[model samples]
Target chain A: MSAQSAKHMIAKNIGVLGAGQLGRMLALAGYPLGNTFTFLDTTGNPSAGIGEVIVDPENQHLAAFLDKVDVVTYEFEHLPVELVKQIEQHKPVYPGSRAIAVCQNRVEEKTLFDRLGIPTPAYRVVESAEQLAAAAAELGCPVVAKSVTEGYDGKGQAVLKAPEQAQEAWDSIGHTQLIVEAFVDFVREVSMIAVRGRDGEVVFYPMAENQHVGGILRYSVAPLPDLDPSVQQTADSYIRALLDELDYVGVLALELFQTRDGSLLANEMAPRVHNSGHWTMDGAATSQFENHLRAVQGLPLGATNAIAPTCMVNVIGLEGDNAALLAIADTHLHRYDKAERPGRKLAHVNVVASSHAELLEKVRACQALIPDAPPVEWSFESTL
Target chain B: MSAQSAKHMIAKNIGVLGAGQLGRMLALAGYPLGNTFTFLDTTGNPSAGIGEVIVDPENQHLAAFLDKVDVVTYEFEHLPVELVKQIEQHKPVYPGSRAIAVCQNRVEEKTLFDRLGIPTPAYRVVESAEQLAAAAAELGCPVVAKSVTEGYDGKGQAVLKAPEQAQEAWDSIGHTQLIVEAFVDFVREVSMIAVRGRDGEVVFYPMAENQHVGGILRYSVAPLPDLDPSVQQTADSYIRALLDELDYVGVLALELFQTRDGSLLANEMAPRVHNSGHWTMDGAATSQFENHLRAVQGLPLGATNAIAPTCMVNVIGLEGDNAALLAIADTHLHRYDKAERPGRKLAHVNVVASSHAELLEKVRACQALIPDAPPVEWSFESTL
Candidate 1:
């Protein structure tokens, strides 16, 4: 769909912030639309090929890449805010600074959630050691003390046994900005993905339950099993309210905690399309990559129905022969062409089936196809 | 899936016979599969870089190109059998030359059908003007007289309104080998796609009612409405019977006519994937393209169930701008990447919906998006 942009920047390309797999996939999806998209990266990542990735632009040349594109979007955060601000001056950045600023820090995201009246766990922003102790006193022991900024994949999150552990939590996170959050009694960790168009339309995909191992996301299944419809409503409401408050554009992902009382608590938000939404590429009517591109271009949002109850399992680098994984039945293997490094996300396989049990069986069958994949121990319990 | 062979051809590369959109799409599909799939074009043609299209291989030095690849396959028939035989001495040609020879001509295919006790229209082989006259007398008026070999897209076949039109029919076809057949009073036309793996396993996609205009396919809808289960069974039997008889490998599309009384008659066959089966790309659990690749590679056939009752419409080049076609809502537009010359097969769009009416609505919406596209008229009787 063509975007109705003003003549001023209609000829401009798009500047993508991060050059990771999402950027590569986005660039691939955008390539069909022609030379409308380009990416500028701070890292010399290999997947950044749809367009040029400016590793480090000089002060004068910095605006050249941003100037070439009409708008800016990002694939990942962790880039300095000052770089984003510099580009924002020359072009518009969707899921703009406010969203990314909040997303960069747990404390800021929670405060933004609280102010927006979104359902989130009770928490306090901690500064000094006294403030950490005070916040813990208000909450309780066994709480989560996490670095407010730049923490991902269970990093910087520490469990406090008492006031003694609180100092270590901030210290473990490099003693940057920190948050002392009350631990919610949760039954499951789930995520919701939605795209907000430039026209202010918010479209949500089916809620999916995310399972992680070693702090890295292992798999995600859509239409979370035995889910209450209310969870969808709450998730949609929370996303819409938050997006509207930020006037967000492009895709957003919300990490949610389903509490014992069946209440959904907001954990954090991602400004760009998240890994949990990757199944939508094969399983949904429109992939998150395509939908995000559409939304940012001011085009119509695509249908978000799950392709089926699909389970997506990520392959963290192959320790042995890659041939076994390639042999998976009817398998659509998406291996990122990045250099193989241990613990690096190599590829993901989406197993689509009619039912959950069948999906599990398919996953196991696929796992068998990949030699030396970590054994999947499947079980469920109600902490409530 | 790896193809086990006397020589692992994919170990080097592979050459495709035709450089049309089918070859182009196949090339795109194979990009992630690790092997560089190239093309051998009768004429140099640009087809989305499936690989380099080598024309005039004899003059260009076939050894140089052939040395670069191992196995060979064609995207479509119309390739000369001698060339295929020549290629076979070096690399295997899928769908085999014997199968192509039988399927490419009407006389051989019809004789094969008759031998298998496969039901088809009454017919007689025609050699000359005298033979045409006699065959017309035998088959009666309003019969079809046509050349046997290398005729497609309703070319060469002519309706004989009277005994005198037989000569004109023969003249129009420039007859080499020909057939005259009684025309069946069928209400609609349908095509079934079946794939045969190297192991001789066969899997069939559901019957699709095809709508054509000017001898070109306009649209095809799957899960043919009100079709008897036995009819599908008959169609499958027709496919399997042919598959076994020819020792066919890769995809075969059979065009069938259902007489007013509900009897099935084999009209013609395509040795490779046909336009009528394009709906399988997004409509089926696995695409016909991917399945053909699998079948030819000795991999297990993918499940062929219709994921959603789907409708596919061909996007023929129109008088005006084709750029707007990219905006079609809920439409998957595949531009051939061919420089559009008016009336050429420019592209096709496949739309999937939960119901027939929704599909029609989506089609209309798509038509609106392609303002420059030729006017699309829907058949009210389209089965979905």
Candidate 2:
């Protein structure tokens, strides 16, 4: 090829389905590679701080947006599978529509995990009040009934503590397909961010121990200090299997539960960059957002080595105090340009240090700067 | 104050005089802090890939653009000082008009250096052919004659080797005001990037050794290897004096020459984020771009510690081979998304390593990937 065409070939225009913080970060990372982005979001103001946002809520103009870009990816998994499939016909949609379709529905996700021999909590599909009662009896008390789709951040889910509450749970969520899962007594919640390249190369970031309040992630510590090497191996193997099965090409976040016996059970998976991997932006040699863009663009994967111990605290629903946040030494603050609302993921703070103690100290100082910040549990033992 | 007012106060809209790579990187670094940028450039397409660009060549709508931003700064030193003065009336122009005016004129810049007791080469202003001959005779042969204004990257300058060449040099650039300086027989070129806060706190990044071809910088290695601490101290003191003299706020780069006797002489200074300090993007705890924004916004300065040894290679007027560039492990590639032209800076490669030897190896590998790249001289003996 002539040099001019070759140069033009290297420059790509990528389209994103959502303009949230993930898309914003993706643009931030991808722009350095000389890549341009066009975002399709319901809101014209996408968290992608800089990009042309096409507001097409009903996906009526997906083709118009698709025609302007060479490849397509989404910031969130909740985008309708059919929309992705339609875009795929015009241009390549990375991570594939099948992966999004499966991950968007709890039943399909769990079934795929089972098929791949990955361990997960026992679950039964519940279609009606009778099925809910039966599944509750089989799974025992305190079984969690989750909507198969359209559920996120503790939404569209309820716990049935007794048989008497089964009908109430069914009445609330039975309008959609559901899955009743046996509540495993997990000791710690952790997640691993893995990426698969177009050429089938797979890599995983170090595991991050997570703490959630009201089902919203509050903070995460990467590499999950003192983690059993075998658990990491198991998580890697399971994610590898999923990547190969879905023929995925982008960042995939696998959430898992560590039970009392030291065994791991799959919780769920995100088809895009995960909140837990946010620490990579400040702590790792390569951030998850950058890696996702690299993988989708078919570039070589970067080193995922952790540069230091890091803690990522989400600034959920609280606004202001930006000046105070900038005062903390060595703390990297990322504010998503989104309107603040209770329970909304507004921004995040990354505190990195040479030691775990120093990291915890800085994290505390950062929290103190924001008076309304949610409590960040510092469980040192998990990182011992 | 209520939290809402405090939050609104933190959100700042910054305007830049030139939308070049420096401004682009500044916008990139500042965006994560929730700061937005509006760039004013003659070119409709600016390197600031992600910000609102206002293309106003005649300055007729300057007030309209200034009305949209809270503060203003410039990317390059060549901008008209009068324009900056006009903007200062509407909003704060960082580094102020005095700094820009002095730095833009070689006569004023060298005068200030002498007044501050900083070591610099002996020179004479040449406004006529007779003055050029007299200055060359006084300074001896091989003197450099440079335009007092609008000179950069080897342009608007000529080196006169013999007395007979003075007439030709004068005839070539006699229309503009010029300064003729005795060229020092220097052993090395080094630079220091320093930042001063609004609160009067000062910090400096480690010195960087630079290599230039045709007066255009080709590469720079940070920390200057085994540079003498005293030399660093001297550079720091001189820069601090300049900062205090100008009441400077934001990043300033001081370029100096290291003679064989180890004495340092000031060459020039850039009153904004500089090319020599680009390695900070990957090597330093806080990049120079981010620190510039911090200083201008009155935010606390970040740590200036170098995380590792780093080398920055400028990609001047070259394109393609992006895949080959990304193939190198741990190499950070920054493409400015500009149309390629001879002598234009289209991109840069930052290679970081744990040790200087390893860094050299990676830098060599990076050079190999770009066939037309300028040679990078790795002087181990100087570093040692």
Candidate 3:
């Protein structure tokens, strides 16, 4: 190649399927690498707040969006699989339609996990309250029933304390099909995020132990002090199997449960960058957003090494004092520019420190600055 | 205080005076902080590809630009001081008109240095060829003559090896007034970048040793391994004095010459975020761009600690292979989206590593990928 062509980046206009915080961050990371973005927002309310937006509620602008972008990727997997498949014929879509189809269905995702020999909470698919009650009876009471589709962020879900409550749970979910899963006595919730490049190259970030309050992720810290190397390896292998089986490209996040015996059960997987990896923005050698962009762009994957012990605190619903939150040392805030709304992911603050103890201290201090921020909680903090 | 107000970043439409790479980067860093930007391009040709640009070649849209923004900051200091002063009446301009006035004139800048007790190369100001020759004879045989105003990147500058070359140098420069100084026999050129908050809180980054070829910076590396803590302190004090004296409310970059005895002589100061500090984008806890925006917006400054050893390579005149450059591990490319031309800075590559040896190796590998990149050289490299 001539030197001129070699030195210049082949600037690509990436077509993003969903316009949310994930896509906003992808564009933010992509721009520095000489890429442009054209977002195709299926929802009428698009919150990317930056970049070019094509609000095609009826898919009227699909052809126009395809014409502008070199490659396509979705920020949220809730996108219609047929739309993704159609776009694939026109442009290359990372992770492809199969990953999305499986991820969108609870039964399909669990079946894939079983086929791949990945362990998960015992689950049974049911189309009626009678079957749900039978499944709850077989699995044990206090089971969780979730809609087979369109479920996310603890939405479309209900807990049945007994077989008698199964009818109420089914009525509450209001879905024709449901997956009733027996609750696992896991000690903590954790997630592993990995990225696979176009060339089938894969890199994994350190496992992050997560804290969820009211079914929303409140905090995540990576390079867990209490996590065994073997436990991390098992999580890596499980995700790697999924990535290879689906011929995936871009970042894939697998949410898992770490049990008292140091075993992990796969809870679910996201075909795009996950919120648990947001700490990588300031804590890792390369952020998950940048890695996702690089993977979809067919560039080499960057190192996923952690730079420090870091915590990511999600700012949900309400905003906090901008000055006070920032005053805490090593705090980096990323605001989504959305107005205050209940349960909305408005922003997140990533705090980095030399040690995990110092990190916890700062995180608690930061938590105090945000009004009504969930009380700072971490499974490892007690051990520390 | 209400939690809602505290959690929100009061979004501001920043009015930038120049639309160059620096302005482009400032906007890139500012966006995640939930800020917007409008560039007021005084020059007909502006290179900031992102953000809103008001091309006011005749200053006709000055009022419109001012009206759109809450506060103003300039990327390039060569702007007309009177224009900044006029804008100050309507809105705040950080680093103010006084900073621009002193930075635009060599005499005023050197006078400020003298008043603040900062050491500098012996110099004399002259208005005629005879006076220039007299200054050269008084300082020594070999002297450097620079234009009093409007010179940057080695432009409007001439080096005299002998006193007799003054007339030819004078005609070559074509400037009516010039400052001639005896060249200091320095070991190496270094720079200190510091940010002063609106309340006068100052923080300094570890000094970066810079390499220049034909007056354009080619490479810069920070947290020099061979540097003593005391030297860094001295450099910090020098810049702190300047920041306090000017009442600077943004990032200030000071270039200095380190003599054999480890003493530093002030070369010049730029009243804005500078090229040498670009390494902070990937290597520091808080990037210079973000700190500059924070200071101007009246927010607390983020930490300035270096994450690791880092090097920044400038892409000048020609482009290199993007894939090859990025293929280097831990390497990041920031392209300005500009067409390449002779002496034009098109992009930069930031290579970071845990140790100086590893950093040097990666930087060398990165340098080889660029078509016409200068040799990777650092004074501390030999020590490593």
- Report the lDDT of model 1 for residue A78: 73
Q: Which ten residues in a row have the lowest lDDT in candidate 3 chain B?
A: B2-11
Deviating ranges (above 4 Å) for candidate 3? A1-11, B1-11
Candidate 3 lDDT, tens digit per residue, B1-384? 555554454547888999989999998888878888999998899988778999989989998898899899999999888888999999999989999999999999999999999999999999999999899989997899999999898899999888799999999999999999889999899999999999999999999999998899999998899998999999999999999998989999999999999999999999999999999999999999999999999888999999999999998887777878888889998988788799999899999998999999998898887767888788777789
Model 2 Cα lDDT, one tens digit per residue, A110-207 = 99999999999999998888888899999898899999998988889999998678889988875557899999988889898999989998888998
- Per-residue CA lDDT of candidate 3, range A208-264, in tens? 999999899999998899888999899999999999999999999999998889999
Question: Would you estimate the TM-scores of all the predictions?
Answer: 0.85, 0.96, 0.98
Model 1 iRMSD vs. native: 6.3
Model 1 misses residue A176 by how many Å? 2.8
What is the C-alpha lDDT profile of model 1 across B279-356, one tens digit per residue? Answer: 987788777876777667665677788888688877665411223333444555455655446557767778888877
Candidate that scores best on TM-score: 3
- Which interface RMSD values do the candidates have, in the order shown? 6.3, 2.3, 1.7
Between candidates 1 and 3, the one scoring higher on TM-score is: 3
- On the 0 to 100 scale, the lDDT of residue A54 in model 3 is 96
- First chain of candidate 3, TM-score: 0.97
TM-score of 2: 0.96
Q: In candidate 1 chain A, what residue range of length 10 has the lowest lDDT sum?
A: A3-12
